[model samples]
Target chain A: MTSYVSDMRRRRLLAGGAAVAGLAACGLWATAARAQASLAMPQPDSAEADRIAAEFTGGAEPLAEGLALDLPALGDNPAAVPVRVHVTEPMTEASWCEEIILIADLNPKPLACRFRFTAATGSADVAVRLRLIQSMPIRAYARMNDGRLLAVRQEITVAAGGCGL
Target chain B: MARPPRIWISNETPAPGEVVRVRAQVVHVMESGFRVDAEGQPIPEDLLTGFTAMLDDALLMEWLPETAISQNPYIEFTFAARHSGRLRMVWSDGSGVADEAEREIRVG
Candidate 1:
């Protein structure tokens, strides 16, 4: 009878240990998931370029081609980097480029500038000077009148003091 | 004090059914508010936030600039060329400071 009682107590203790270990494993998994979620958020010195594009495109994923992003691969000065964008397609009253959104992935604010055009804005080609904070990929999203989001990306290296200001 | 804006057109007088490029520049520091002074004080933002180009009576294009634009911003765009009466450009800042210029566009 005493052996039977001792065996019961040992079994209970073993079960309790097993429960504790399972709880520990659950805790580990929860912590790991939280860490991964945090990592998935925007990284430092980076912008969620895709997310911004989607917002502008009314939640439609942008087509990754069709825009001509003209800029220097290496920028000797971040203060004034020349950038030009040309939409190769024809512009018409029925269909035209409505706007162009310029995004600097590493800038404090990703949406750098927006150029709005109409059918009378012939060619849909525009150029401007940009101020980049660092070396990073930049994107130009063109929103067409027909509800298409056209995108192009370019990577640039700043050669001097960062243009943070 | 803000300086006057300067504007140039690739061709003021173009043949019918032609496209002309328009270049506009406004002189300003385009000071971004994110900077810190030598004493680690935040600088105030001063920028030309809006630019509009009009060909005669129609709006050709508009540019919305932010802190990421360089000082003395140079913007270039294109418009359908004709014997437009005028090409007008207006540059404005956030706090109501504005400057504008107009050029007569005549076809031969």
Candidate 2:
């Protein structure tokens, strides 16, 4: 009878130890996952977004609907995404365009590319290839000759595996 | 008194009225000489820093590169062709080494 009682106690202690070890393993896994997520800049912060906005707008608040930026529907290759920006307004001498800038909202550095146009260029069709860290909002801002700032944004879903990761 | 370099040009046959794509790659070690050798002595720097390509007496491209370039430098450019002639490639290094090579092309 005494041996039976001792065996029951030993079994209970073993179960308790196993439970503690499993909990510890789970905790360790969670901590490691959090560390990895922190190391990745999968999203842009408010300050970075503001800096990108100010680069072309010169601190003036940009009107968010005048320019149109087109991005890929699905980007399986995160290394390069084909982007094109088209301005509907007529480009003329008096209607000259100043500059166009591309911003990747989720990239570690949001400022991607910039192009300054002259009055001689009558069309605002700019084609370029860019690297996307992940799926994020892409923005295009146009500075007009009249000194007005126009901006547009589009969201794209980027698949896993990209450059600079 | 080194071996004569060999230069090859792609796009031997170009269109009648098209920009001729020219790609030239040469074999040479562009040593900066700043790094120390395994024996703890400063190695002398030797590298090609300047290169010029001409087509029938017309300068097509000229470049000034730093020592950070790879051992073999590859250059690409465009030349508007009028007729067939010899393309000359000339290069010089900081170590006082100079070399030249040539290739012929037919411009349709």
Candidate 3:
């Protein structure tokens, strides 16, 4: 009879340990899910892109000159639309382009890419391919080493049946 | 093993202080992880996350790209050559896998 009682107690202890392990596993899964959710891309919106740019520029309006954003006015293929960004200003140690950011207003994730440059680069010219969901405006924001912000925007119309299908 | 990427430069023999164009392309599906497979499984996002160009150990430029970039990514940029050296291009994916290509350029 004593052995039976001891067996019951051991079984109960084992079940309790298993429950704790199960709870830990659940907690880990929840943490992973939250992390993934935070990384999920937000929907496309030009206003959202503007907000991001404003934040980057410290709530200041970026000058729309000295920077050129090149893209086809009519994009034949949205899946691989070509974009080129250039800052006409000279890149010297005292005044150089610090970073260039590309934003596609209609893409599910508007922030496409960012290129960082140092005085060693000598110039701020970058070309890249992006995915566009529809007809929308694309913007390029450039930050100079001297803390000046410059931006340029271009509108492109894409035909039906592009990326994000 | 993945295939080696293709890299192209517009001016292999550029004069000193001249700006040379560099272009690179890599073949990859660039899965965005937003799609569901036929078996109801979420497709994991895989993308080229970083690119850098170095000239004889001197960093020239670096790019941090996002998933919005298209498949078989193509990138182009220009840098002024001050001297003759080996220009190395490296591209890395989200999985920490990196592929590199190099070109020798002569400058006066």
Best by TM-score: 3
Query: Per-residue lDDT of A66-158 in model 3, one digit per residue for the tens?
Result: 999888877788778899999997676567898999988766677889999887788899999887777888899999988889999989888
Question: Which has the greatest lDDT?
Answer: 3
Give the Cα lDDT of each candidate: 0.80, 0.63, 0.82
Chain A superposition TM-score per model: 0.69, 0.69, 0.70
lDDT of candidate 3 over B19-64, digit per residue (tens): 8889898887777777665456676888789999999988889998
Model 2, chain B: what is the TM-score? 0.79
**Compared with the real two-chain complex, what DockQ does model 3 have?**
0.28
- Runs in model 2 deviating more than 4 A are A1-46, B1-108
**TM-score (C-alpha, index-matched) for candidate 2:** 0.46
Best-to-worst order by lDDT is: 3, 1, 2
True contacts kept of 3: 0.60
Candidate 1 per-residue lDDT, tens place, A134-159, comes to 77888899999888889898898887
Tell me the tens digit of each residue's lDDT in model 2 across A118-147. Answer: 553444555444556677788888888899
DockQ values of all predictions: 0.26, 0.04, 0.28
The collision pairs in model 2 are none
Estimated TM-score for each candidate: 0.79, 0.46, 0.81
Instruction: Output the worst ten-in-a-row residue range by lDDT, candidate 3 chain A.
Output: A33-42
Candidates sorted on TM-score, descending: 3, 1, 2
